[model samples]
Target: MDLSYTDVANRYRRQTLSILADERPLSVSELASRIVAHPSNDATNESTETQVRKARLALYHVHLPKLDESGLVSYTHETGEVTVPEGVADDLAEIAETFRSQMDE
Candidate 1:
């Protein structure tokens, strides 16, 4: 199957992916909150509850399904947990680490 790099390029999805690079098995609500708090989404800072709700909806309806389909993540709806698959996590973590290092330079 062709990879949907578009899934990774989307703003919410990108933020989700970036976030999961360092953390996984996060509760849906917690993940949504963190996404809202990400630097690029600072506009959400002033509207925490609203952003969290929107992010939760987006995550449940769009982002998580796409990422799960890509085999990059596993979303357990019953448990409300999201986790990066072992195979993909290492690669993404490495990329995230490198990007973080470059930003620090």
Candidate 2:
């Protein structure tokens, strides 16, 4: 639930926030696909179905719940949907960009 920099600094969480920033109200599975497909995700091959499945599981059971707890995202368990709260997406994108730039350096 910590909304500290370290929380969003996590790769999966950061990616989730950034994706939600642009494409609000995505299902966790869809978010996982985007995360896996993201260019910065060097940890796995984006084209792999196994990788997507793994990412989806991690997002659903770990990242999304944590982000939801932190109030950065709204996650509906039954519907499997995730959304950033109103007016928060731009800020979330900025934070994610900051981290991305730092990591790039």
Candidate 3:
């Protein structure tokens, strides 16, 4: 929890660090697309919002759970919200850029 993304071993965590650079909570579906789409492409529409992927099961079943377990985010199945806890340092935004660049590659 204390280590930065460069020091952290899990790439998923690093990827998520970048995804959450916006420092706001997002619905599960939005999180999935943000994981794959370039930041410039992050647009939310009620019709297309749920269209991030088919059924969005992978995000529900896989990624969010992994993130939730680490205490990095708060996921509420009932509310469909994934929240980034406060108090994390702003240096993480750099990790987000790094992860974004890596995703571009």
Candidate 4:
């Protein structure tokens, strides 16, 4: 499934915020693991390493760029480190809640 730019941006923003809320910059692999480990409403399958890999690529190549453009996150491609922008954590939390709610519905 193809995601629109806004969709991608929102996902990246929320993920970045969630990661940064922990107060540490994360490598791409670490970020991917966190995202996959994060609980969701979907009950059919759990996230796997391959799923994480796909998410990482999507976030790194597409979503991160948009988030960077919006100044919602700062990323260093060379080291695969990502930091969430200031004041975006609440919004990301809200978005994450909404996503979970939608999946439950």
Q: Which candidate wins on TM-score? A: 2
lDDT score, candidate 3, position 12: 44
Model 2, global lDDT: 0.80
lDDT of 2 by residue, 1-105 (tens): 236875675789888877776787999889988888887767643457888899999998988888888889999999999998875776887876766676566
Query: For each predicted model, how many residue pairs clash, with residues at least 3 apart or on different chains?
Result: 0, 0, 1, 0
Residue 14, model 2: lDDT of 80
Cα deviation in Å at residue 5, candidate 2?
Answer: 3.2
State every prediction's TM-score relative to the real structure. 0.82, 0.83, 0.62, 0.64
Model 1, C-alpha of 99: deviation from truth (Å): 6.5
Candidate 3 per-residue lDDT over residues 1-105, each given as its tens digit: 565333345544565567677756877777666655545343566544455573357668766676676566677899988777665536567656776776667
lDDT of 4: 0.64
**Candidate 1 residues 27-95, lDDT tens each?**
889999887776655453456898899889999998899888888789988888998887787777765
Candidate lDDT scores, in order, read: 0.77, 0.80, 0.63, 0.64
Candidates in descending TM-score order = 2, 1, 4, 3
lDDT of 4 by residue, 28-95 (tens): 77777777666751343644867788778977897777766776667888888887656665565565
Q: Which residue pairs show collisions in model 3?
A: 18-96
Candidate 1, residue 20: how far the Cα is off, in Å: 1.2
> Which scores higher on lDDT, 1 or 2?
2
